[model samples]
Every structure is written in C-alpha cells, then in structure tokens.
Target: MANNDDKSQSKNKPFFEVQKVENEDGLGDIFFGVDDETTKFPDYVVDFKDEIEYFISVIQLLYGDTKSESLYKKYYERLFTIADLAFNSPQEKVKLAERSLHKLKSELTTSVGQRIRTKLLMDYLKLAIWPSIIAIIIVLLGDSVLTCVLAFLGKGTENIYISSLGLISIAAMAGGWISTATETRNLAFVDIVSVINNQRGILVRLIFINLFSIFAAILMIAGFLKINIGGLDSLQIVDSPTVALAFGFALGFLDKVFVDRVEAKLSKTEAK
Candidate 1:
C-alpha cells in the first residue's frame, strides 16, 4: 500500500516542460525541460542541448516559447513569401505588391516582425548605396585629374595666368562634388543613413554646388580661349579675372567646411 502511495505522489509532481510540438495528433506534446538561455545577437543564434531544452527556455520568456515562437515563424514566412511574389511579378505590379506586403507587416506587433522589417530596410539601403558609390568613384578620379590637367595645359596659352587660375577653380568644384558623392554613398549604410540624410536638410546647397561647377567650367573655357588669342609672355596677373574668382571660391569652400564641422559637432551633442 505504501509503495503504491509513493508512486502516485511521484506521478503528481509538476513536470519540467519544454515545447508542445505535435506528436501524432494535431496537438503538441511537452518534452522534459532543461533550462537554457541566450544573450548573443541575431547573427549568432543560440545552440541548445536538444529541442526540448531550447523550447523550454524560450517558453519561459514573455511571449516566449509559445506565442512568440509561433508569431515570429508566421511573420517571417509571410514576409519572405510576399517578397518572393513581389520580385517575380511584373514591374507594373511591383508597387502594388509592396504596398500589400507593407500592410501585412503593419498588422504585426511582435519582435520577430520588427527584426524582419529591419532586415528588409537594410537590403533596401544596400541597393540604394551602389549608385552613389559609383558616382563618387567617377568624380574623384575622372574630374579631379581632368581639371588639374586642363589647368596645367592652360599655362602655354595667351592668357596663361588667367587660365591657370580657372583650371584651379574647376579642381575645387570637382572636390566639392566628390565630397557630396561620398556623403550620399555613406548614407547607404544603415547605421549612418539617418545622420547623413538628416543633415542634408539643405537641398539647395546641392544646386548651388552644381551651379558653381557650371560657372567654373565656363570660366575655364573662356580663359583658355583668351590665352590662345593672346601671347603667354604677355599674360599679366593684374588683368586676370580668374584670380578674384579663385580666391572667392576658396574662401567660400573654407567657410563651408567650418560650418559643416560645427554642425556635425552639434549633432553629436544632440544625439548624446
């Protein structure tokens, strides 16, 4: 009688539980539980002794093993499914499909959904950055060298002094474009995009830079023509308009650099 009583008591003890997966019936079964927890980030998912142990720990957390797991799996599957459909669809249907997917994402409130969205955003940024990167490379190498070469060649022309100054101005314009291109490309990275775009609130600045470049190019062409029409030996610094233009441009550039540095510092303070 005592042995039977002891056996009954043991059976009634609370069982440590893992996950409830479908055994044979459409319902789940709880395997024996052993506790395991993870602290690492997504790039490194945690390893477990067994499925039962893993599920048990997950179940223990808020929205843990049960609802959270199901929610994540469902959202992740949905996100990928929608993405696949969007990609395979015709161009005309792409925007519509993306809207539909976005709606589906909005319905989700779980951590899993948030993570999936973050990944999607990163992918989008990677695509955006490529063009800006290419532009930067082209401006840095192509424009920089060409402007300098053109300016040096201007020395042999009739207005040698003026042409040289014009060439230097072109180089400065190239430098500004190179910086803009670089900044835009940097914005493609997920970590820095917001900061880059935020400070870019002044869209007019880009227009001004482009206009400056155009003006500089025009000046260089005019200076070259003037030099070829006159004799290089007769070229005088006092008569050169390029000198004033180059000086003004250089001063403006320095001012811009100073302002940008100050703004960056303020932004950092605000962030903190």
Candidate 2:
C-alpha cells in the first residue's frame, strides 16, 4: 500500500515550478521556470517556457503605454495564468492553454493598434482643421475677396484675367477639400490608419489639385480648350468671366480625372 501511494504521487507531480515575487508596488510577478531536474522536462514544455517568456516581455512593454490600465492588467494576469497552466497542467490541457494565450495576444495587439491610430487621427485633425476652413472660405468668397484685397492695396481690381485666375485657384481648393471630406467619410479602420500614417499626403494632394486646376484654366483662357454650349454658340467659355469661373470650378472638381487623362495623353505622345 505504501509503495503504490508513492508511485501515484510521483506520477501526478508538475513539470515546472511557479514562484511569486513581489515588486516594490506589492503587485507580484509570476516566475515561471523549469524544475531543477532539467532532463525530466518534455520538448513541448520547453517551447511553452520560451513562448510564455516572450509574451510576458511584450506585456511589460505595453503595460504603461496602453490607455486602460485595468484592461492591460487583466490581460497580464491572464497571460501568467495561461503560462502556469501550460507548464503545470496535464499534456492534454496544454493545447487549450496555448490557444487561449494566442487569442489574448491577438486581442491585446489589436487594442494597442487601435489606440495608436485614434491618437494619430486626432493629431492630424488638429493640424488640418484650420487650413481646411480657410480654404473653404476663400473658395466661397472667390474674386470678391481678391477684389477687396487689391482695392485695399490701391491696385486695379478690374483685370478679367486676374479675377479669373483667383476664381480658378480658389475653386480648385474647394474641390480638393470636398474630395478629401468625402473620402474620409467612407474610410474603414485600416484605410484610416493608412491615411493617418500619411497625413502630409493630404496637403500634397490639394497642392496638385490647385496646380492642375490652374493649368487647365490657363489652357481655356488661351483658347487651347474650348466649350461650346449646345444652343448658345455665341457664348464661349473664354469670352465671359461668369463662364470662366464655372469652368474653373468644374476643372477643380474633376482634378483627379483631368490629371490622369493628361498623363495618359502625355505618355502616348512620348511613345509616338
């Protein structure tokens, strides 16, 4: 009877030892290590030790930086619990522990990524809001605002070409703003992350739109591009200031398509 009890106890003994070491803050750390009898450990137990150590290191790195301390602490505790189970539990239960740890790691990583993306988006909005507002105002006011500035400087405000140029530039800015707004509204989480990562691209895109708008407007003014209304053949785009302003707005609104077409045409010309 005594020999049978000894054999049963030896068979039920765990492969690893877990010790609790308290920090200065009194929150203890779980020391998960192999037993002194190193040769008795199985191959899977060694792999679990390595993976759990890595998980602990990652948790420590993200603990203070994450927004919700309680949430992180919960995951930290769960990680150690899974490690303990992986080491101490029967061979059949080890796979369950591994799966749990993997799921927890995925959730923690996604949470951290989302928090980082949210911060980037907020910072971008703060920098972009004022410029967007100013652009919209300039677009709406167009030549009236330009005329006021020119009048204040005691310069002639009657030049049709000057007014047309101002109109084109401001209208282009408005078109770019509208395009950006629409794109932002439709963005998904991953798309937003990409946008936030490249915030400077938004400004660059607006600049391109303005440049293309101005270029197209110049072509119209120079008689290289013509618009003939179906019934009113007498009213050409270049002849009237009102028509010029509307045409500039259209060019600005369709800046991307216009630019692409221009590029394709240039590429074909080069091929020829």
Candidate 3:
C-alpha cells in the first residue's frame, strides 16, 4: 500500500514545482537558437546563452514578453542593434531607442484619411485667422473708410475704400499661395499632384495669415499717422482708409523685392 502511495505522489509532482518554467512555445529555439535533438539554432540568431538570457531579462523588465517579442519581429532588421543598445547603453539612451521605434510606428505611411484631415484643418486655420477676420472687418468698416477717403482723396472715397479692401484680400491671398508653393518643393514630384488637388485648404490658411499680417501692419502705420480706423479707436491702425490700404499693399508687394536687393547688396559687399 505504501509503495502504491509513493508511486501516486511521484506522478502528481507538478513539472513547474521541479524547475524554472521554460518558454515552450518554440521561441527559445527560434529566437535564441538553442541546440537540441528536436531543434537547431540558426547561424544568424545564435548568441551566447548568458547574453541571450541577460537580454531577455532586461527587456522583460521594460515590457511584457509578448510586446518585446513583437517589437523584435517588427524591427527585425535593426533587432540586434536595438537589443545591444538597450542592454548596454544608459537608461536614457535605451529610452530614446524605444521612443524612436514608437515614432516610426506612429508616423509610418500616413493614411489617406489622415492626410485629408490634416490638410483640411490647416485650410480651416487659414480661413479663420486673417482672411476671414479681415474680410469681416473690411465689410463692417466700409462706410467709415468711405467717409475718411471722401474727406481726403476727394470725390467718391467710398468706391476707393471698397477697392482698397479688395486689394488687401488679393495681395494677402497671393503672397500666401506663393509661400505655400515654396514650402512644398521638397515633397516628391508624384506626391505634389495629390498636394495640388488638396491645396484649396492650405491656400486658405496662407491667405488669412498674409491678410491679417498686412492689416495689422497697416493699423500700426495708421497709429503712427494718427488716422481714425473705424471700430479701431486704439492708437494703432489707419489715419485714413485709402492711405493705409495703399501703404499695406505696397509693402506686401515690395517687401520681398527689398529683401532680395538687400541680400544681393550684402553679398557684393562681402565678396569685396
């Protein structure tokens, strides 16, 4: 009876209680290249047993085995380099490598939907910022500008005031469009077609920025001249409507020309 009891107890001894549990899912043989009758280590993946063991320990500390395994597979081309750095490098460096992997994953080939959303959001910003604001302001201040212009520029200042607002929008929008074109020169030639198709959104933002910036500049100049800008009672902005708009338009066009001349002059001076 005792012999039978002893045999039963031996059979009941759990495999886990006898030894440290191994990864029996075949990853040990495949990833680490363990040698046995049932498995063979490939020449490429073989590392020292101690090195493999230590690497697994360190990585497991950072992430679960499943995550680490997935990352190893995904970044297989850079697997050893990443693993080596993570094991040997300082904590900060290791963290950086991990973050780089995540960034690559996140930004990897943006979807069509993502591109459209990004482009649209940028366009909406353009419309909201200066273009829309200036448009509304120009419409509201039409009568005031007419009154100011008629007093100064003589007959039919209202016509001139209306014209000035239109000019501001055109100049601002054109400048912004050109700037956007320059910005996209680096995109692949093939990609530029798609960019062009979606450019309506981007064009809107630039228009707004240019429009508002020029308007603000006009306001500042007007403030200097002590012009009464409609609804803008502050010390800054238009002394007279037509003059302010004309000055801003000239500046919007001439600024780039002036900058180029200055650069050329400086280059000649430096060459001498």
Candidate 4:
C-alpha cells in the first residue's frame, strides 16, 4: 500500500505546467504544452490532444532551427490528414514523418519534376513483393477458369478453342487488382491518394512486365536458369498462365532492383 502510494505521488508531479505571467495591465500569453510560456508553435501544428505532441516533435526533428513557410504548409497538410484518419495511431504519423524527411533529403539535388516522379515510383513499388505473387497466381489461373466460362455459356470445356477464348482477359484483370491494393500503409490523404490514377501509363508498364515474366518463366521452366538439379523445371511448379504470371509480377515488384531503375538511370544519363 505504501509503495503504491509513493509511485502515485511521483506521477502527480507534472510532466509540464502551463505557464502564465501577470503584468499590471493583464496576464501574458499562457503556454499550455511547452516548458516556457513564450514558446510558440508553428501554424501547421494540429490541435488534437492525442497528436499534438507527435506533431510538435516531428516539426522540431525535421526542421531543427531552420523553419520555413513552405515546410509549414507541407506539414500542415500532412498533419491534417493524420488527424482525419479513422484510427488515431501515432505510428502512422511517425512513419509519414520519417518518410517525408527522407524524401526531402533525397530531393535536395534533383529538379522539381524529376523529384515528384521519383517519389511516385517509390510509393508505387512499396510493399509490392508478396502482393505481386498473389497477382500472378490470379493471372496463371486464367486458363483453367476459362473452362468455367465456357460451361456457363453452354459450351463444352473439351473444346480447346473455346477454353482459350478471352485468353488474355484474366491477366489484365489481375494487373488491375494489384494496382488497386497498393496502399502499402496508412499515409496522408495526398501521399498515395491517386497512386493508380495514371491508369494508361501504369497499365502499359504492367503489360510489358507480364509479357517479360511469361517469357522468362518459359526459359526458367525449361531449365534455362542453369540450375543443374533434376526435376527442377518451371512446370514442376509454375505450369500454366497462372504460374507463368509470377515471373512478370516479380519483374514489376522488383522493378527497383531490376529494369525500371536501370531505365531511369539510363534516361537521366542520356538527358545529361
């Protein structure tokens, strides 16, 4: 009982006390959060009690002593989105702050348009690995699924021509679905709000990716990847359009580690 009482007494000591000063004319501005009453917050700071500390901390962490109106507007928009989310977890705000800081640092030497494009590509490829695999499975399953479509249309599945009808439709749908779920994690409204809105460009790239993956899968399944082990053909695992789809999906998902970034650098070099 005494130990518990002592702990309670210690906690009763204020983390901070709101400061106020008295003058003959009136009372001075009261400080509610900071140690000193004169400490003022940036206009971008959100007023939510749950997030106020985090917002202030992030502002200080990112800007340090060098504050700017541009940063204020940026942080204001981001903080507003953080407070608007349904679930108020601090982790999301912290993650956003970290990424924003990193993005700002990386963009220091890049032109404005180039920086925007880079940021978009980075977000597009985030959390794409396993999701890409799932998308490939959907595409590969397309061939088998065509039989069901044929049966529904009163056609027999035994007819090879009928089962192969609308052959590429399933792969297209799988790519579309992958683009839809690329949210990655909770972020500010403006961050990834229209991640797939550039539909034509995205679809074109994904199509190329899918084609390349199919090509690579054929070689790999044929023992072309040069593994000397027996029974290690791609058909031993990735047999149909569904299985072959994995290679293309991997290409897109691993674009950062593969062709996309390589192409980007080559373009930059050519421009230079």
Q: List TM-score per model, in order.
A: 0.21, 0.43, 0.30, 0.27
Candidate 1 lDDT over 177-197, as tens digits, reads 444444444222122324323
Query: After superposition, which runs of candidate 4 have C-alpha atoms over 4 Å from their true positions?
Result: 1-176, 184-197, 226-272
Q: Model 4 — TM-score against the truth?
A: 0.27
Please name the candidate that would achieve the greatest lDDT relative to the true structure. 2
Sliding window of 10 residues with minimal summed lDDT for model 4: 161-170
Query: Global lDDT of each model?
Result: 0.40, 0.61, 0.45, 0.42
lDDT of 4 by residue, 123-165 (tens): 4454334445555464457547777788889987763321111
Tens digits of per-residue lDDT for model 3, 1-272: 99998777644332111112235542322133212432443332233333334444333332335755764444333434544443333321344445554443333223233454456446645654665566667757766877886788766543334444544555545554445445554453234345645555455445544555455554444443232335443242234545544444444445464345445755877899
Candidate 1: C-alpha lDDT: 0.40
lDDT of 4 at 191: 33
Off by over 4 Å in 2: 1-160, 223-237, 268-272
- List, residue by residue over 1-272, the lDDT tens digit for candidate 2: 99998777666667777665644544445676555754576677677677776665555554644364675578668877887676666432567787887787677656565564455455545654665566556545756877888899999887435555656666666665555555555444235335554564655665676678777767666655444434322124435656655665666667777777667766877899
Arranged by TM-score, best first: 2, 3, 4, 1
Q: What is the lDDT for 15 in model 4?
A: 32
* Candidate 4 lDDT: 0.42
- Each prediction's total of clashing residue pairs, residues at least 3 apart in sequence or on different chains, is 5, 0, 5, 5
